[model samples]
Target chain A: MAVLNEKMIENTSLNRKDILWMKIIKQRQLLVLCVPFMIFVLIFNYFPIWGWIMAFQKFVPGKGIFGSEFVGLANFKEAFTDANFINAIRNTLLTSVLKISTSFVSAILLALMLNEVRARLFKRIVQTISYLPYFISWVVAVSIVYMALSPSSGIVNEMLVAMGIIKSPIAFLGEGKYFYGVVAFSNVWKNVGWNAIIYLAAMTGIDPEIYESAIMDGAGRIRRILSVTLPSIMPTIKLMLILNLGNLMNVGFEQVYLLSNPSNIDASRTIDVYIYTYALRSGRLSYGTAIGIFNSTVAITLINICNYISKKIDGYGIF
Target chain B: MEKKRSHDMLSKIGYRRMTAEDLFLDLFIYISLLSLCVITLYPFINTIAYSFNDAIDSVSGGIYLWPREFTLRNYEKILVGNKAISQALFISISRTITGGVLGVFATLCVAYVLSRRDFVFRKVFTPFLVFTMYFSGGLIPTFILMRDLHLINTFWVYILPTMVGAYNIMFMRSYIEGIPDSFTEAAKIDGASEYRILFTIIFPLSLPVVATITLFVAVHQWNAWFDTMIYNGMNPKLSTLQYELQKLLTSALSIAATDTDATLASGDSQKAAVTPMSIRTAMTVISVTPILFVYPFLQKYFIKGLTLGGVKG
Candidate 1:
């Protein structure tokens, strides 16, 4: 680590600016500072890069990525044809879309509703409590889900029965059809409050005078909110949307991994889980890498396209 | 107009206060808010109850509000079985603490350097870090990298891989930016080395974000079972509590949850079988309690850390 830092400054001096080497040497102090972090990124982030080559090779455990014989395009071919791989790509896209939309709309609606609170003390309490679930790990959160949706004795089923919806219980975790909805709803529930945190910060940036002036003009609360509040937070919303678009193919691996079952296999097979199954679980190194590469390619393209479109439409991009 | 307005206000204050408009809105808001709060907290509460309840109650019927049949037997069962749980806890806690410390220090160092206005290479390295955030070496190479470094099944593998967080580094750097650079420059004039300037001056001033990042990293370590799942999945002893419980409970939920005594080896040939529900419940409570205890203490600083970090980083 020290070696890495020293190297950043050894060639550059603190006084020189014209030479790139001198610039580094000149800020030898700061360059030295970047050493440990750079080494870490090198060791952790860069080291694994060799594995991407595995996508083109036929990787075996003992032989590893380097030792494995190159089997060009075989894994990619397999991934394209493999129903599981194709389904995973589709499901991942679907879930990310659902989460982005639900989280976007719900968080705004929830925040708007929250802003109406006259009681400061009450609003603070509500804000804190709502954000608590986002902290729980998937393992803990899923258990709560299991308890709430347990077929014979889940609280949700119990309530549904009491309300005369169904005489029998619905097996939430045991079905394939409800998998998307379950993943989407649980994700929205976990994230809506947390994601709203950003918008809330943005909302504070809105001028109070806008609201006051609207009231002065005898505009009702609804009209002022539609015209002013939404317009003010539009930049934040668009920025968030673009960022969300960037990870369109990377819906979570943990929660879906936790909730997935043989029965729900059709609905819950996302690319992350699929990658885990192939690379981590089954030890199909090349195949997993190929799938991951494909997924990321699609995600990156989608993000770039979205960024361009948004830049054209609204002249804003996170980049 | 002033007299009429004052009289209107006087009349409004006569009862409890308000023109009846504020009162109903307050009730509507409070009720709506209370229900949402219930939705938020209800799941966490149920899991706690499930952890403590008897094994049979978990699978048999519904349990809400409280355990169907209270029992400490399940906890005993898991404890008595594979001494792996105890070892996993110790391993995970130490790994997180040690790893978190190193990651924070390294990240702070990088962030500090980048925060300097005079650093020319900051721009060069900034994009490098962001680029890595967007892309990762596919799994095959990463595994190979770990293998080459002899990181397999070693503690350094965990600590070293996480030694830098560009996101956190960005946050810390931006935060350090807020600190006046004159202090560091003055320290330099006083003949303090760069190391001293970092430790004595910059680090002390960075307590708030540092504390917040600590919570973030610590929580990350606690919540993350994936590392253990990937690196040491085969080594049951090295598996953290979260991963161990996840594996055992998810596969054979009841088998891991049953009481040891209930399934105790008989004088003959019979062996033990864990009761699934109780064991899962016990594991959930055990794993989550320490972290949950930690949240409220760091809540204030941690909350600010995320929002502020998000904006600047």
Candidate 2:
């Protein structure tokens, strides 16, 4: 009886295996479609994680990752002690804070102003023109900024001098004091229109009856906006804020890199640019990898913390 | 009649008579908006004016909305007089088209597979793909991987790393899932394979999203100079228009700095035959013209795409 029971159990397990195999065979076309992408993702996305091991090693290009000496947390220690890295962290946080706050407020304000516009053609034209900068490359945008701020010939300087706002043209990009402000202003100029789309979308979902009731209550346009529209879009505002806060670490490598000249290099070198300058440019591969790891860790932790807070408040997380 | 109805509706909604305060508010809002438009547009107009002004003449400053010394010389120098600019332009266009096409097709394939609710592995693959959106292996690792794959300094470096984006895939999948399953079900019932349904039915249906993704990827590729700077910095043959523009801008700024210093020393200003300002402005125009050409289509679809993604988020 025991032998018969054991054989029957074995036969049932084999039958379950057969079922799974049959399902895979029947869905072979789908499998064929998926496997290549899976492989691509594995190679491009997953395989890079293997290189993170270098963060713990004294990695050398000649010897490669495998032959590199095992240094453990020394590289990470070096990163923490490095003055440039610390300064980079400060710049990254400072610029990111400035950028996030300014862009957020400007985008919302622009949307509110746009929502108040009565002329559809005027609104459409303004919106279209605003989005123009967002689409162009930072290279082109920076070039435009350079020309517009050029002390010798830029319209900005010319206008300022003409208006007697200053005795002479100021080199906005040539000073460290103006770096963060210029970065923040340029960010708002590029993204304010694009960013406003979300708030505008949130506003569209506001019930018209709410506005009608406010108007009936003797609410002026400003009061109606303050009470009806703002409250209605509060959730969206929170979500956008949380999302932006989550990305506090990534202060846009390309924008800062392009904007940095020798004059502003001290203020503009964020962690991302630091990694590039050290690892790729100067060939300190392992130390760069260590800093990169630190940056990623902080970013992921921030995202999770934000995600948790969002879930607590909204009952749904971004994930 | 329509205007009358709208007026009636407005009144019914308690539209008050325009008080002096209301008129003042209206004027404030309109003027603010008008100024915003000017601030946004004045830069481009100024750049265009500089590009068209004579090279030496632009050095004297004060060109605002229109060219003071109207000449085609700047455009001529960029479009015809220079070999490097043309080569960079060619490379930029080629990469944009190739990368855009391949990226769309790859994203669609992955999206279609994940959109299939009946597919047994959809649950597994969806999360696996979406996780990539939140985390990455960072820069150095990605650069090392490119080197290992022999993609460094090659044109393929531009195409491959960006071929399959998680955000685009998710966007495409959400769009694909919106299409009724009945169509694909009917195709399957007719003994049509998944490939057939994807090509004959899904691709045609997903053209709007396709155009949207194509624009996103193409613009990204066109605007990308960092990749060229990192991966192909050594190879002039593979230099993109944006990268070339970057090179030009750097040299121009340095030269302008020294030129000013020289003037300061001598207490007299001298104009070069062709200033770095003119070349930089001309290159800027050349790079931006293609984007402006496609701006209308971009404006139409990108808003739709943004709202769609916004809803999903």
Candidate 3:
């Protein structure tokens, strides 16, 4: 890292205007190396930002962005009034907030528990199993949740019935009331271990001497953890919390889309799914574009707000 | 030695002696971790059990912990002579391999260039990459861009748009930056070109991060279904296993909900024996099996790589 920074200084020392041409000629290989990536980024990443102009247009498929009629916030007005759009925002926020809290708490607890374990092999084994679901796609994760909660052949329903917890099988997936909890729990189950890894890493960063000092002061295991470990990792915890809260608008479209059916659509619709439904399926391109812009704006605002709050509360933030 | 003193201290503190409070804490930790392990694993186990159980008997629903009436019929139907499933699987596997290789190469190229100390473009391009992480053009415009590029519904659609991820490029660049400049500087002094230095020297040293990122890209490509659903849903030949599996499950559920009684009462023995429940479970097992198989072995490297990102952040 130091070498590269030093090299940058050495090469930039040529103040003479004539030497600039020679420097460019000498660095031809590096220039050649950068062209392909620059072209790809320009096309794929930057081009889309230019495409956002469609949000202001009465876009037609063949008319192109240049030919499309400039409507000027008409699409945004429509999106704000649309019931489906409003419902999507509500559901997206509700699900994101629920998932963020549950997963955060579980991950912290899991990390703390893992830290207390004395056996190395046991810790490794536990970690391996915990992160297994992280590798599986939402398609697979939703299917597992689906099969387990199936009203007919599902083991969960069967166990509940046997234990007299319910009079009969409940269609857990079919009910709107249970949708938030189901989505939140399933998201936590899949990501808890993966999230725990960050906390675990943060725990390792805490000085061992602090723990020894606490032990000398006759602090018990739990006491030491409370007094030393938690406070030491508080900065990481705050950073992660702020980062996650910043992404509160993204409720993971795949989970809701896959798990949703006619019975659960009312509860499951989110901004991403709503965009796909309207823009791609119905071809209401301009309205979807407006809503998409709205979604991203809200997310960026939330991130900035959260980062500011974190900076004030703690001394650090992602920015 | 420090270790010996720690060991002595451990014994002195009753860590080895096991006081009642220590014993209680130990027991509590073990039980909690073991239960967590069970909870994490039970869903997979149950899916396997359902896949193996007799479809007809599974509906009565006493099957727990293991299959009651074992059968390979589910596997046979899925694995043998089913053109749709076979095609989807083939497409998925091929795309994962092709996309993984191309993605890694593209990411490595861009990251390597940006990692260069004296590259004038680095200052200009770095912000271009970082800006995308915080904000984007969003769904519709990106879709339109793809349409304009004629990438929609084509095989290139799957591999091209995602070929260079901003996050991956940043991580890879940072990893490369950590490589001492002396190595590349000495090679440059020996008349080595940038490409030669990258491939011969830097690439070999970067195997760990490279492997980690490659596996990540492979897993992502393998599991990806959203793009397939959106861009290429009309093209069956381009369908991935995940997309197919999703279709299979939803269709199966709707069919079961509407025709459960009709199908059962018709008394057609073979159809009755292999219910939609069994087929869905079987498909779930088949699709996830590869990830489950490879995950345990590669988990250590993955954990290290992920934690590296966490700590760096």
Candidate 4:
């Protein structure tokens, strides 16, 4: 009987191919609709990926990826050995870690606080106001930061002097030590509310009876939140954390670029910035591609590892 | 045990009532929220204040919350001072609308096709879309490709290369999946073509996601300067508002670095009266005002879209 079923399936698949062609003919317009998009994806996405071969080659302008010398792992080795490359990687990781932790905490706290708000109007207004910065461009945002922290003419310096907190203005952007903190804080301020939306959504899904029961058990609002709300949202928290862990290397290019200058280059030169400088600015195409290859490889590996761990822990993975 | 029992009894009596603890908590929450609101709005307020103040007076500093010596000259300069400013504004607006509409349409096409469960080619194409999200050719090769394609230094490069976003396509696909298969199946039985069913049915049902992606794309286009910086490459005609703003700030910084105020003067005496700081503030205001204007009405949709992605995605 099993042999007969297998034979029938094989026969059906043969027929299925004919049916598929029929369906294609029927849905010919849909295929036409998808054609332009497919071409776009190919040119914009796949073409670039195919060009990654330049990372392995001594790529010259006229030679193209095909005609270039395939020195094989030499560029990768060169990238790994460079002090600037290592610094970029280090800076990327440091800022990413700082940003992830700070934003994660801020989002959680804000979401919790928002959840505690009794007045609907107040919560909505606060939430609305907070998301404004998220929509503002980093160019504008960086300008705001620069103006606010400008040594000679900044509001911060003025206020500090008025309050006698300091006799002189401190060059916030000119220092290396403050760069990570500044980037992290600015990032948190911009994204905290937006990030909190996910947590708030998860909170809304928590069963109301759990909170009722906690209250019945004489737990205060804080205690109820701790025992009921936090526990219920642990999966979401874990999910977001793992997702963020995957992006540990992408310390947002725009923010770093806009904020970075010669003074803060020591702390601000992330991998993306480094690649941009080499590849586009200096026109060291092959060397930059090699660094990009390194950056992407590490990022993909981190994501996979995080996905693996997430699955192991919770039977759920992004992939 | 007795104390616990008494506490439970007391709590049960006042479960609906605000206790002293609740009162304190409410106070803390309100104070914290208000403070946060102030902090969030302070820089924006400061920018506005600086934008209106006299340029030279602003250089003396200490304009914190409001314009000290109020004037409309800075805005006048931005509006009528330079043709590039208005030109950049037009470019920014045009690109935002054009890019947003086309981007959404292109993304939706990929998403709708991929959403079809019976499409035999979906397995092949879905991975093609998803693979791009994780890996890319990197900067130089892609730039080289754009340069080779002659897409460099053109407006098409802005819209075409970014026409489709992989994550957005996936998000839309996930959204479309939530739409019942029965509707499409019924349409199929009625002899409605796939495109007909998609346009007539799926498109209407997927408005929330569509609106979400539109806002996302529009905001991105509006905020974009890096592309202009790279692709446009000092082509003043193609520069967007944000790019022009960056240039203004950069030039101002460079000037501030070398000369104090004498050589900073431009041919336009009106603009020269407004210090670079004030001019920059005005430019910042110009850059942000449009987003701020439209944000309130669109805020709910963005929040909804995010939660939709969070839950289903």
Task: Tell me the tens digit of each residue's lDDT in model 3 across B140-215.
Answer: 7888888988998899998988888888888788788989988888888889888899899989988877887887
lDDT tens digits, residues B1-313, model 2? 6544553565445435666756777788899889889989888988998888877667677788899988887778777878877888899999999999999888999899888887878888888888888788989999899999999989999998878899999998888999988777888889998889999999999988888898889999999998999999998899999999898776555443234422432443343245667778888888888888787666767787778777777
Tens-digit lDDT track of model 4 for A1-319? 9999999999999999999899889778778878788898899887887778888888888887778888888888898789988999889989999999999999999998998876679999999988989999998988888887777777777889999999988877777788998899889878888899999988877766566667768888778778988998898899999989988977889998888877678898899999897566887788898888778888899999999999999887887
- Model 4 RMSD, rounded to 1 decimal: 4.4
Question: What's the DockQ for every one of the candidates?
Answer: 0.37, 0.56, 0.59, 0.47
DockQ of candidate 2, scored on C-alphas against the true complex (2 decimals): 0.56
Model 1: per-residue Cα lDDT at residue B51: 66
What Cα-based lDDT does every candidate model obtain? 0.74, 0.85, 0.83, 0.84
TM-score, candidate number 3? 0.92
Where is model 2 chain B poorest over a 10-residue stretch in terms of lDDT? B256-265
The list of candidate 2 runs beyond 4 A from truth reads A1-16, B1-16, B253-272
Candidate 1 lDDT over residue span B1-313, tens digit each: 6543543443344334343655665577678778888988776677777667766545555667778878766777777665878788888798779878887888888888887776776677888897776777765567767877888887676677777887788778778888986778888888887778888999999998898778777777777787788887887767787887677546632221232223332222322234555666688778777776776676667667666755642
> What tens-digit string does per-residue lDDT give for candidate 3 at A1-319?
9999988877677455457677678878877876787788788888888878888999998999989999999999988788988899899999999999999999999999898886779999999989989989998898888777877767778889999999888787787778899899998889899999989988877656667777778877778778988998888888898899899998888888877777777788889988886676898888888888889889999988997898798666665
lDDT of 2 by residue, A132-196 (tens): 89889999998888787777777777788999999888888787788899899989888898999
Model 3, C-alpha of A217: deviation from truth (Å): 1.1
TM-score of each: 0.87, 0.94, 0.92, 0.92
The per-residue C-alpha lDDT of model 2 at residue A58 equals 89
